[model samples]
Structures are given as C-alpha cells and as structure tokens.
Target: MKIAILGTRGIPNYYGGFEQFAEFFSVYLAEKGHDVYCYNSHNHKYQEKTFHGVNLIHKHDPEYKFGTFGQFIYDFNCIMDSRKRNFDIILQLGYTSNSVWFFLMPKKSINIINMDGLEWKRSKYSKPVQQFLKLAEWLAAKSGDYLVSDSLGIKKFLLEKYKKESTYIAYGAYPFNSPNEDILKEYQVEKENFNMIMARFEPENNLDMVLEGVALNSEDKTPILVVGNHNTKYGEYLKNKFKPHENIRFMGGIYNLQHLNNLRYYSKLYFHGHSVGGTNPSLLEAMASQALIAAHNNDFNKGVLKENAFYFSNPTEVKNLLNNSKKSNNLPFIKNNYEAIVNEFNWTKINGDYLQLFEQCMERYKAGKSK
Candidate 1:
C-alpha cells in the first residue's frame, strides 16, 4: 500500500503524541514493504528526506510566524502535495486544520482520518474557534472514506454524533525496562520520594487544578515535580501562583525519552491531568514506566486505565489521594498497567492493527470499484 501520513509537524517525534504515532507507524509500515510517506514541516528539526525506511516529505510551515493560523496554510500545502502522490491510503492524524481541504484530497486515495478527540471542547480556543472546530469535525467525518478513533469513548462519540462507525485503534507505548536510579541525583530527588506530573500547561488539561491540589495538600509535605514547558503565558502564571509551595518544583520541557521514562519510573505518584484526549501517549508512557497514576476523571482516561488507576475529578480529589497515597498498595495497579502495554498497547500490535484496518478499507474500495 502506498500510504501518506499527514497532520503532524513531522516524524522522529519532535512534538506531541500524533507525531510519535506517525514516527512509529510510518517506520513500521515501511518495514512491512508498504511505501509509507510522512509529511514534515519545513522547519522541523529533523530535515532529513527519510527516517528509518519511511520517506519524508517536507512542506513549508509558517506556524513560527503566523501562530495557530499558520497550521491551516501548512495543511493546505501538505494536501496539495498529497494530491500528486496518487496514494492508496491517506492517513490523516487529525482534522483540526486539514478538514477544510477535504475537497482537494486525491481522487484515487482512500482517506482514513483519525478522529483525535473532542478537540472543540478544549478551553484554550474561544467560542468562535471552538464552533469552527466543531464544523471541521463534521466536515472530516462526512468527507473521509473511513474514520479511526483512538479510544472507545471517541468511537462511541462519532457513532452518536454523526452516526459514523469508527474503528477504535488506541495509541501505543513500550514497557520501560531500563531504570537508571542515578539520574534522580541530578534533579535532587530520590526514587519514589516525590510526586510528578508531565503535561502541557493547558487549562483543559487541568494543570492548575493539579497544582492547586498539591497546594491544598501542602501540609503533607510530599514534594511534587511539575514537568513540561513553563514558558507559556499560562505556564508562567502557574509558576507564579504555585511558587509559594516549596514542595512543588517546576521542571521545564524535557525532550529526552530516556530521561522522561526514568523520571516516570522513579516518581512516587504520576498525575495525568489531560481531560480531553483519547489514549494520550503520555498516559501510556506513565503506565509503561510503572508509575502510580492519578488521572483526570473522564471517560477517555478511565477507558484506558479502567480500574487500574487512581481517578481524580477535582483539586479536592487530588488532595485526598496524595494525603493517603502511602497507605495504598500500588503493586497491583503497576502490574495491570504494565501488562496492558505489553499485551495491548505495544507498538508492534498497534502497527499491525493499522495494517489490518487499511487492508479492510482496501478490500471495501476494491469491491465498490468492481460494482
């Protein structure tokens, strides 16, 4: 199959979850003898023409200059290039900016869109932008040849909202086997001696709420580490608000996978505050690292963690969890989460699932053409 993956900044995962998915899935597809192409932003750090066996196509992305609006231009460029490729499958990772060009998609290609999450529900966007996003979601659902959902919750959503049946294919993660305890010394923390949360500082993510929980539980004196870039306006505000809590340490954006894995493995309790996404990569990584998780109380997180994680709905719940954390036996939760990664959420299985879905789509397409 000739497949082109778009909607991410690029492969080799310089950015977020979808980029990570692109990097792994593209390489896997390439290794399986399918001609796979991953589109990259012209400004992406990795300027190479190929990664592993996967082909890389670089297009101009002016997000640096025009901010969020630049994404629309980038998606347009990618779609324009994709029309020339004559791909068998065009795997769009998200539809936030790309749905507008659905009309321009290659005629010969079967477009399979990964309906990411309830993106319109994000608190970051204004009312108009959110409404626009909802329209885009509908457009992508109507336009795509098939839809893929990363979680069962999202699949149910598509079914209820658009009467569309979407294939549920969650993101993947590998189990963390290498644990270097010495790395903790650099951060002035000991193994399981501190709590931690790693997420983009966003309102919807409930980063502030998580911090507030820590602040409310301040008397317990359990040190908590806040990881991710604190350079954003919201991030800075969080820093200033939480600075008075001496137990809370804000570690800026960390790019190293090994370091992140190590941190997750060593942390006493890992808080996952992402409230909107479906099968977020970070949540899987935390589970893989055997981190004791306290995720946001939502269908998305609950669907992934099930009864295997500690669920928190608000700052009060977070406070209560931290206060009694030591009394909780984390072994069963750790065991269950690790098994999930190994058995279900591993990259090999996920890549195979994609292959199976693509083959099914191809068969259906062929049947339609024969008719």
Candidate 2:
C-alpha cells in the first residue's frame, strides 16, 4: 500500500511527538514493503530526500516567519501535492490547520485523522481562537473518512460531542534499555534525588501549579528540572514566577531520547501535567523509562496509569506526593509501567495496529466506491 503522512515537521524526530511517531511508524511501514511518504517542512534540519527506505516529501513551511498562520500554508502545500501522488491513504496527524483543506484532499484516497487533544479547551488560545479550533475539530470529524483517538477519554468525548466513532489507537513507546546513569551527572543531579517535567511551557499543561508544589516543599530541595523550550512568553513567565525557588531548574528542550530517558529513569519523580485529551507520548516514554509518575488528575492519565501512578489535581496534591514519595512505594509502579510499555504500548504493536487500520480503510473505501 502507498501511504502519505502529513501534519508533522517530518521525521528523524528533531521536533515533538507527532514527528517522533511518524519517524517510527513510517520507517516500520517502509520495512514491511509498503510505499510510505512523510511530508517535511522545507526548513526542517534533516533535508535529505529519503529517510530509512521511506520517501521524503519536502514542502515549503512558512511557520518561522508567519507564526501559527504559516502552518496553514504548509498543510495547504502538502494537500496540493497529495492530489497528484495517487496515495492509497493519507494519514493526517492532526487537524489544527489541515481540516480547512478537507475539500482539496484526493477523493480517491481514504483520509485518516489522528484527533489529538481537545485544542479548544487550552487556556493559551483566546475565546475566538478556541471557537475556531472547535469549528476545525467539527470539520475534521465530519470530513474525515476515518478517525483515530489516542485515548479512550478522547474517543468517548468524540462520540458524545460530535457523534463520531473513531478507532482507539493510543501512542506507543520503547523501553529505555541503555540507561547511562552518567547522564544524571551531566545534568547536575544524583540518581533518585531530582524530580522532572518534560512538557512544553503551556498554561493548560499545569506547569505553574507543578512548580508551585516544588517551591512549597523547600525542605527536600531536590532539583526539579523543567525540560522544554523556555523561550516563549509563558516560559519567561514561569521562570520569573518561580525564580525565587532555587530547586526549579529550567533545562531547555533536550531532544536526544537517550539523554531524556536516562534523566527520567534516574529522577525521583516524573511529573506529567498534560490535561489535554488522549494519551501523551511523553507520558508513555516516562512509563517506559520506569519513572514514578505523578500525573495531572484526568480521565486520560487515570485510564492509562490506573493503579500504577500518583495522581494530583493541584499544587497541594503535588506537594503531598513529593513530600512523602519513597523508593519502596515507587519501585512497583515503575516496574508495572515498564511492563505496560512492553506489552501494551510497544512500537511493534503500534505499527501493526496502524497497518491493519490502513488495510481496513482501503477495503471499506473500495467497497463504498463500488456501491
């Protein structure tokens, strides 16, 4: 089968979650003898023509110059190109900018959209922007031939709100095997002596509240490194607000998976504050890395973690968890999470599931056309 992947910054995963999955999934499909094309921004650092047997389609992305609006131009370019490619399926990773171009998508191919978190509920966007995102979500749900929900919570929400039934395919993770404990030395922390957060500096991610908890518990004084790009306005705000707390170290975005996994493995507690819908790739990676997770209290996190994680809805809860966390209590949760990664969220399983879904889409699409 010939497939085209749109809606990411292209593979080798220099960026974030979608690109990471696209890199892994596309390479897997290519190895399985399927023709795969992953679209990359023209400005993406890895400008090669192909990556690991998968075809690379480079399109002009103006996001650097025009900000968020530039993503629309990039998606438009990808959509226009797909019209000529004769792909069997087009897997759009998200609908933020691409849903508007649903009309232009190739009619012969089946469209499968991975409905990411509920963007409209994010606190960063204004009311008007939120409304626009809702409209985009509705458009994507209505126009897509198939839809994928990464979490059961999101799947339930889609059914309830849009009456759209989607396949529930959560993100995948690989167990962190090569743990270089020395990586902790480079980050200026001892094993199990530091706490960490590996999310973007967004309001909805509950970063401020998490940091507040770390600050309130000053007696422990274990460094809680915040890993992400902190150049944004919100990042600066966080830095300023938490400046007095010496324990909160803002370690700007560390892309190397080996380094990140090592950090998570050695950390005393890993905080996942993403309140967005669906399963988060970082949360999965933290599990695979055997981190003792204290996640934001939400249906999505609870659904995945179940009894394997500590839950927190506010700074007070975060404080309580941090103040009393012990090695004995954390070990079993870490072990169970690692097993979950190997058995449930493994990349091998994820690749197979996505391939099966694509094949099913083809069968259903052809049958509909014949009728």
Candidate 3:
C-alpha cells in the first residue's frame, strides 16, 4: 500500500504527539513493506530525504513568518502535492488547520482523518475562533472516507454530536525499565525525591492549577519539577506567579527522551493536567514508566487510567492529594498501569491495528467503486 501521512511537523519528531505518532507509525508501516511518505516542513532541521526507511517530502511551511495562518498554506501545499502522488491512502493526523482543504484532496486516495480532541472547546480560543473550529470539525467529518478516534470517549462524542462513527484507536507507549541515575545528578535532583508535571503550559492543560497546588505545599522538602517549553506567554505568567516558591522547579523543555523517561521513572509522583486530549503521549509515557499518576479528572483521562490512578479537578484537590500522597500506596496502581501499557497501548499492537484498518479502508473503497 502507498500511504501518505499529513498534518504534522513531520518525522524525526522534535515536536509533540502527532509528530511522534508520524515517526513511529510511518517507520512501522515501512518496515511491514508498505510504501510510506511523510510530509515535512521546509523549516525542519532534519534535511534528509529519507528517515528510517520512510520517504520524507519537504514542503514550504510559512508558519515561522506568517504565524498561525501559515499552517493553512502549508497544508494546502501538502494536499496539492499529494494529489499528484496517487497514494492509496492519506492519513491526516488532525484537522484544525487543514480541514478547509478537504475538497482539494485527491479523489484516488482514501482519506482517513484522525479527529483529535474537541479543539473548539479549548479555552485559549475566542468565541469566534471556537465557532470556526466547529465548522472545521464538521467539514473534516463530512469529507473524510473514514474517521479515527484516539479515545473511546471521543468516539462516543462524534456519534452523539455529529452522528459520525469512527474507529477507536488510542495512542501507544513503550515501557521504561532502565533508568540512568546519573541523569538525575545532571538535573541536581535525587531519585524519587521529586514530584513532576510535564506538559505544554496552556490554559486547557491546567498548568496554573498544578503550580498553585505545588506552591501551597512548598514546605515539603521534595521539589515539584515542571518540564516543558516555558517561553510562551502562559508559561511566563505561571513562572512569575510561582516565582516565590523554591520547591517548584521549572525545567524548561528537555527533549532527551532517555533522560525524560528516567525522570518519570524515578519521580515520586507524575501530574498529568491535560483536560482536552485523548490518550496524551506524555500521560502514556508516565504510565509506561510506572510513575504514580495524579491526572486531571475527565472522561479522556479516566478512559485511559480507569480506576488505577489518582484524579484531581482543581488546585484544592491537587493539594489534598499531595498532602495525603505516599509512594507505597500508589505502587499497585503504578504496576497496573505499566501492565496496561504492555497489554493495550504498546506500539506493536497499535501499529498492527493501523495496518488492519488501512486494509479494511482499501477493501471498502474498492467495493463502493464496484457498486
């Protein structure tokens, strides 16, 4: 099968979840004898024409100069180029910026869109922008040959809200067993002596609430390390607000996966505050590392963690958990989460599922054409 993956910054992921998914999924498909091509931004540092046996196609991405509006241009370029490639299938990771171009997608390629979280519900967007996103979501739903939901909750949401049926395929994570204790020394932190929160500092992610909870418990000698890109306006706001708390450390964006996994593996607690997305990669990584989790209480997080992890909604709830928290009490839950990753969320299983879905889409497309 000739497959084209779009709607991401591209492989050799220096970015977030979608890029990581592209990297892993493309490589996996390529290894299984499928011809896979991934679209990359021209600005991407990796200039290689091929990465891990998957073809890389670089296109103009004006996001650097034009800001948010530039993404639509990039997506247009990709879609227009994909029309000529005559791909068997096109897997679009998200529809926020590119859904408007669904009409331009090649008729030959079966479009399978992974409808991500409720983007219109994000607090960061204005009411008008939110309405536009709702329109985009509708366009994407109507245009795609097939739809994919990363969470069962999201699948249910599409059914109720849009009367759209979608395949439920959650994100994948690899278990982390080996930990480099020396990496902790580099960060000036001891093993199991710190609580951690690693996520983009966004309003919807609830970073402010996590910081507030940590600040209120500053008397605890064990520090709470916050890891992510802290250069954004929201990040700076949280930094300034929590500047007085010595125990709350802001370790800005560490991309080193080994070191990051070691930090998660050794942490006394891992706080996942993502309220919108389904099966967040970071949350899965924390679970894979067997970290004691205190996640934001929502259907999305609840669907993944179930009754095996701690839940919190506000700063007070976070504070209460922190006050009563113990590593020993969370041991069973941590073990259960690790097993869940191996059994349900492992990349091998996820990759296989995607391949099967692709085959099913191809068969259905052929059958429809014959009819």
Candidate 4:
C-alpha cells in the first residue's frame, strides 16, 4: 500500500511522540514492502535527504512557533504534493490541518488520523486557543476516514464528546539493551539511587507538582533529576523555581539515545507527572528500561499502566510514598512491571497494530464508505 504520514514536526523524533510514531511506522512499513512517505519540515536540524528506505518529503514551514498558521502551510504543501504523487492512504497526526478536509471533497483516499491527545485540554493554551483547538479537533474527527486515538482515555473522550468510534493504539518506545557501567557513571547516577522525570515542562504535565513533592521530601538523600528542554518560559520558570532545592537537578534535554538510556537505566524510580495525553513515550521508555514506575495518580495513568505502577495524586501523597520504608525502589512489584513492559511495549508489535489499522481503513475506502 502507498501510505503517507502527515501533520508531524518531522522525522528522527527530535521533538516529541508523534515524530517517534512517524519514524517507527516509516521504517516498519518499508520493511513490510509498503511504500511509506513522511512529511518533514525543512527547518529541522535533523532534516534528512532520505531515511529508512522510505520516501521523505520536506514541507517548507515559514512560521517558527508552529501553531494554526504553520499547520495550514504544512497541510497545503503536503496535500498538493500528495495529489501529484498519489497515495493509497494518508495518515494525519495533528488537528490544525483543515486543508486536508477541504481537499477530501474530490478524492476518496483512505484518510486515517492518529489523534495523539486532546490539545484543547492542555493547561498551556488560553481560553480562546482552547476553544479554537476544540473546533479543530471536531473538524479533524469528522474529516478523517478513520480516527485513531493513542490511548483508551482519548478514545473514551472521542466517544463521549463526538459519539464517534476511534481505534486505540498507544505509542511505543525504542528498546535499548543493557547500559554499561561507564555509561551510568557518565550521567552521575548509580542504579536505583536517583529518581528520573523526563517530560516537556508544561502546566498540564504538573512539573511544579513534581518539584513540590521533591521539596517536601527534601529530607531524603535520593535526588530527582528532571530531564527536558528548558528553553520555553514555562521551562525557565520551572528551572528557576526548582533549581534552588538541593534534592532536584534540572538537567536540560539530552538528545543522544545512549545518554538518555544511561539516565533511564540508572534511575531508581521514574516519575511521570503528565495528567493529560496518552501513554507518554518517555514513561514507556523508562518502563522498558526496567525502572520502577511512579506516576500522577489519575484514571488516564491507571488505564495506561493498569495498576502496575505506584501512584501519587498530590504532593503529600508523593512525599508520604517517598518516606515509606516499605516502598523499596527495586521491589519485586516494580521488577515485574518492567518485565511486563519489556514484553508489551516493543516497537515491532506497536507498529504492527498501526499497520493493521491502516489496512482496515484501506479496505473501508475500497468499499466506497470513506465519506
């Protein structure tokens, strides 16, 4: 099948989860003898001339911030190129691309969109932006021939709000073999000695809560290393507010996979504070790295980890958990949970789920029901 992946920041996964999905899918699909094309931004530093035996199309995005207008440019360029090149299916990842919907009038290709999460509900956006995002999401759901939600929580949201059916397929992380002693020493962390939290510094992710929890549990010697990009205002604020505390270390984003794995492998506990979105890639990578899992206690988290992780809803609960003598970092429960993740979150299996979903959408399109 000729498939095109649309509406992402770009490939090589330098940004976030959607790019990772695109990268994995492109490689996997190419291996399966399917023609895969990924839309990329020319401004990306990792912009490749080619990748993974799959075709790469660079969409020139003039805007730097990459909001609504940026999406318009990307979609317009991608859709125009796709029309000339032709494709069996077009898979979209972001909602701001209403141009794809407008072009759907004439052609009836299989349009499957992987709706990552509810961008409207994120704490970063203002009221007007949120409302606009909500409208964009609705249009995206209605436009797609098939909707794919990364988490069951998101699928439930779509069903409740739009009364529309969506396929649930969570993002998967690249697995790393065991790290060496030298690698661990490089990160200045011993195995099971420091807690790690890797995520974008956003309000919805509750970065402040994690900092507060660390502050409250300051008596403990176990340091919490927060790894992320601190370039944004929110990130700068978080770094400023939390850096004063000795228990927390704000290590800026580490791009190297081996170095990242060095941190993930040596950490005693993985703290996921994201209250929004699906199963985060970093959290999945931490689980895959055999790290003990502790996340913000919420139904979305519970749904993803399925009672296999320690949960803390508030700073008090988090501090209490840290103080508890019974909560050993390398407990059997944690080990077993990591084992389960190693078995479950493999990229091969996760990508296969997407392949199947695309096939289903193609079949539907062939049956002339895509509209």
Candidate 5:
C-alpha cells in the first residue's frame, strides 16, 4: 500500500516523541514491502533523502514560527501533496484535528490520526489558543476515519469529552545495550553513585520541583544530573535558578542515543517528574536502562510502572528519598521491570501494532465511514 505520514517535526527523530514514533514505524512498514513516505520540514535539512528504506518528502512552511498557523500550512501542503500522489492512506500524527479538509477532497484514501495527548489542556498556551485547540480536537476525532491514542488515559479523555472510541497503542522504547565502563565515567556517574533525570524543561514536566529537591539535599551523597535543553525562556529561568547550585549539574539537550543510554545505564536511580501526559519515552528508556525507578505520583505514572516504581509528589518526599538511609531496595523490581518493558516496548513489536492499525483504518475507509 502507498501510505503517507504527515505532521511531525522530521524523521531522523532528533527532537520529540512523535518524530521518533514516525521514524521507527515508517522504517518497519518499509521493511515489510509497504511504500511509506513521511513529510519533512525544510528546517529538518531532510532535503528529499531516503532514511531507513522510507521516502522522506520535504515541504517548507513559511509561516511555521507562528505556532498554530505554521502547523496549518504544513498540514495543508501535506494534504495537497498526498492527494496529488494518490496515497492509499494519509496518517497525520499530532496535526490539527480540523484536517478533514484534506480527506474531503481526496479520493479513495483513509484518514488516520494519532491523538498525542490533551494538547488543548496544556498550561503553556493562552486561553483563546487552548479553546481553539479544543475545537480542533473535537473536529479531528469527528471527521477522521480512524483514531489512535498513545495511552489509556487519553482514551478515557476522548470518550468522556467527545464520546469517541480510539484504539490504544502506547509509545515504545528500544533496548539500551549497556555501554562500556569509560562511557559511564565520562558522565561522572558511577553505577550506584548518582541519580539521573532527563526530560524537556517544561512546566508540565516539573523540572523546577526536581531542581529544588536536589538543591535541598546539598550534602547528600547522590549527585543529581538533570539533562534537557535550557534554550527557551522557561528553560533559561530554571538554569538561572539552579546554575549556582553545586550538587546539581544541568546538562543541556542531549542528541546522541548512545551517550544518553550510557548515562541512563550507569545511574543508581531514574527520576521522572512529568505531571502531565502518559507513558513518556524517556521514562520507558529509564526502565529499559535497568535503573531503579522513581517517578511522580499520579495515575499516569502508576499505570505505567505499577508496583515496580517509586513516586514523589513534592520536594519534601524527593529530599527524604535522598537523605534517608534506605539503600534503594527496588533493585529486583527494577530488573523485572526492565524485562517487561523490553518485551512490550521493543520497536519491532510496537511498529507491528502501528502497521496493523493502519490496515484497520484502510478496512474502515473501504466500509465508507470516511466521515
């Protein structure tokens, strides 16, 4: 089948979760003899290249920096190009929910959208923008032939909000082959001497609380290394607030997977404080790293980790975990947890689920439920 994937930053997956999802799944589909093409922004420097046996089609969005308007342009062009090329299915991941405009004009094509999260519920956006996003979410679900969600939480939200039933496919992470001794040493992290927390510095992720917790335990033995980009205003604020502290080291956004894996593997414990969203890739990678898991207390994290993880809802709890005499009793649980994630989240199995979803979407389209 000739399939086209639209609405991600780019394919090589240097940035976000959607890009990584597209990159891995597209390659998997291509290997199975399906022709898959992914939309690439010119900013990605993709330049009409082929990656992982899938075609990367580049399109420029001149209004991209304006946020929603830029996304509209990208989505518009992708739909236009897909119609001209006669793709069998057009899958838009985290694009505008109002993209039914594309499917309306196209012939004999399936529209499948991946509802990333409660994007409209995000605290970062203005009230008007949030309301606009809420409308888009409703229209996208109302118009698409099929729907995909990354978590059960999102599935519940969709059902409650829009009364829609979406197929659930949680995001997956690849196995991290343990790195060499010197690799771990480079990060100044011994196997049991430090804890690692890696995530984008956003309000939802609770980087400030984590930093404050680390700062409180100044004399604690376990040094904390926080990895994320400090390039934005929010990021800069956290950097300035914690830059003077000595026990915490804030390493900016890391792009290399190997280096990241090395750091994850050597850590004594993994800290995940994301208060929003469900089943984050970095959290899954930390589980795959065989590190003792400590995460924020919430239904989302608990649903992902069950009894195998620890949780901290506040800075006090985080500080106690550091200052207490407990010797990280979660080792066996962590090992078993690692194995579970390895089996469930391997790119191979996860990609297979995505392929099957696409097939289902096509079957539905043939049944004439394109609305």
Candidate 6:
C-alpha cells in the first residue's frame, strides 16, 4: 500500500505527540513493506530525504514567519503536493489547519482522518476561533473517507455529536523499567525524592490548577518538578505565583526521551492534568515508566487508567492526595497501568491495527467504485 501521512511537523519527532505517532507508525508501515511517505516542514532541522525505510517529503511551512495563519498555508501546500503523489491512502493526523482544503485532496486517494481531541472545546481559543474549529470539524467529517478516534470517549463524541461512526484506536507506549539514577544527579534531584508534571504550559492542560495543588501541599520536603515549554505568559504567571513555594521547580522543556523517562520512572508521583485529548502520549509514557499517577478526573484519563490511577477534580483534591500520600500502597494500581500498556497500548499492535484499517478502507473504496 502507498500511504502518505500528513498533519504533523514530521518524523524524527522534534515536536509533540502527532510527530511521535508519525515516526513510529511510518517506520512500522515501511518495515511491513508499505511505501510510507511522511511530510516534513521546511524549517525542521532534519534535512534527510528518508528516515529508516520511510520516504520523507519537505514542504514550505510559513508558521515561523506568519504565526497562526501560516499553519493553513502550510497545510494547503502539503495537500497540493499530495495531489500529485497518486497515493493509495492519505492519513491526516489532525484537521485543525487542513480541513478547509479537503476539497483539494486527490480524488484518487482514500482520505482517512484521525479526528484528534476536541480542539473547539479547548479553553485557549477565543469564542470565534472555537466556532471556526467546530466548522472545521464538520468539514473534515463530511470530506474524509473514514474517521479514527484515539479514545473510546472521543469515538462516542463523534457518534453522538456528528452522527458519524469512527474507529477506536488508542495510542501506544513502551514500558520503561531501567532508570539511570545518574540522570537525576544532573537535575540535582534524587530518585523518588521528587514529584513531576510534564506537559505543555497551556490553559486547557490545567497546569495552573496542578501548580496550585503542588503549592498547597508544599509541607513535604520533596520537590515538585514541572517540565514543559514554560516561556509563555501563563507559564510566567504560574512561576511568579508558585515561586514563594521553593519546593516547586520549573524545569523548562526537556526533549531527551531517555532523560525524561528517567525523571518519570524515579518520581514519587506524576501528575497528568490534561482534560482534553484521547489517550495522551505523556500519560501513556508515565504509565510505561511505572509512575504512580494523579490524573485530572475526566473520561479520557479514566478510560485509559480505569481503576489503576488516583483521580483528582480540583486543586484541593490534588493537595489532599499529596498530604495523604499512600501511593506506595497502590502498587497493584501501578502494575495494572503497566500491564494495560503492554496489553492494549503496544506499538506493534497499534501499527498492525493501522495497517488493517487501511486495508479495510481500500476494500470498501474498491467495492463502492464497482457499485
């Protein structure tokens, strides 16, 4: 099968979850003898023509120069380039920027879109922007040949809201048992002596609430490390607000996978505050690292963690959980999460599922054409 993956910064995973997905999925598909092509931005540092067995195609991305509006132009360029490729299938990772150009997609290819988390519901966007996102969602739903939901919660949402059925396929993660204690020394933190929160410092992620909870429960001598791109306005506000509590350390964006895994594995507790998104990569990674989690109470997290995690709704609940820290006693819960990752979120299984889905879509497309 000739497949083209779009809607990400590209393969080496310099960016976030989508890029990581593209990297692993593209490589997996290529290994399975599928001709997989991944689209990269012009500004991405990697200049390679191919990664692993997957082909790489670079397109002009103006986001660096034109800001938010540039994303649409970038997606447009990708779609335009894709029209000439004659791919059998085009996998769009998200529709936020490209849904408007669905009409431009090649008629010869089957377009299967992964309708990522509810972008219109995110608190960061203004009302008008949210409305526009809603329209984009509708356009993608109408234009695509198939839809994939990363979580069951999201699958139900599309069914109920858009009257559209979507395939449920969660993200994947590898378990991390080996931890380098030496890595902790570089950050001046000891193993299991600190708690951690790793996420984008955004409003929808509930970073402010998590910080409040950590600050409120500062009686413990253990430090709380916050890792992300905390250079934004909200990040500065959280820093100033929580600076009085010396126990909370704002460790800005550590992209090194090994280092990040070590931090998560050795943490006394890991907080996952994402209220949106389906099967978040960070949450899965934390579980794989055997970190005792305190996730924001939401359907998305509950669907993944089930009875295997400590849930908190508000800052007070988070603080209370910290004050009465009995995470060690919940060894079974931690083990359950790890088992879930191995059983349900394995990368090998996910890649196979994607391949099967593509085949199914192709069969259906052929059947429709014959009719």
Clashing pairs in 4: none
Question: Considering lDDT, which of the candidate structures 3 and 5 is the better prediction for this target?
Answer: 3
Cα-based lDDT for every prediction: 0.91, 0.92, 0.91, 0.77, 0.77, 0.91
For candidate 4, what is the lDDT? 0.77
Model 6 poorest ten-residue lDDT run: 213-222
TM-score of each model, in listed order: 0.97, 0.96, 0.96, 0.91, 0.91, 0.97
Indicate the TM-score of model 6.
0.97
Q: Which residue segments of model 5 deviate by more than 4 Å?
A: 63-68, 97-107, 325-328, 367-371
Which residue pairs collide in model 6, if any?
none
Give the CA lDDT, 0 to 100, for residue 361 in model 1: 92
User: Which 10 consecutive residues of model 4 have the lowest summed lDDT?
Assistant: 97-106
Model 2 weakest lDDT span, ten residues long: 323-332
Tens-digit lDDT track of model 2 for 1-371 = 99999999898888778998999999999999999999999988998999999999899999999999999999999999999999999999999999999999999888999999898998889999999999999999999989999999999999999999999988999888788887887899999899999888899899998998888888878899999999999999999999988889999989888999999988888999999868999999999988899999999999899999999988989999998987566688988999999998998998899999998988888898899
Summarize candidate 3's per-residue lDDT along 278-343 as a digit string, tens digits. Answer: 778899999998899999999999999999889998898888888888888778899999999999
- Tens digits of per-residue lDDT, candidate 5, 1-371, equal 89888878779886688898888888888999999899887788566589989998888765557765776776677677777888898787874533546445366677788887777667778899888777778778887667887777878877888888988888887766667668766777776688778887778887788778888887775678889887889988887898778768877877888887777777776788887775678888887777677788987777778798778988888887666523256667777777877887677777888889887767766676645
Residues 1-371, candidate 4: write the lDDT tens digits. Answer: 98888888778777777888888889899999998889888787776667887788888876577665777776777777777767888888867654345554227467777777778889788899888888888887777778888788989998998888998887776666667757767667777678888888898887788778778876787888888887999988887787768768888888887777777776777788888876777777777676667789877788767777788888887777666624354467556656656666677778888889888777766676645
Off by over 4 Å in 6: none
RMSD in Å for all candidates? 1.4, 1.5, 1.4, 2.7, 2.7, 1.4
- As for candidate 2, its clashing pairs are none
CA lDDT for candidate 5 = 0.77
Candidate that beats the other on lDDT, 2 or 3, i.e. the better one: 2
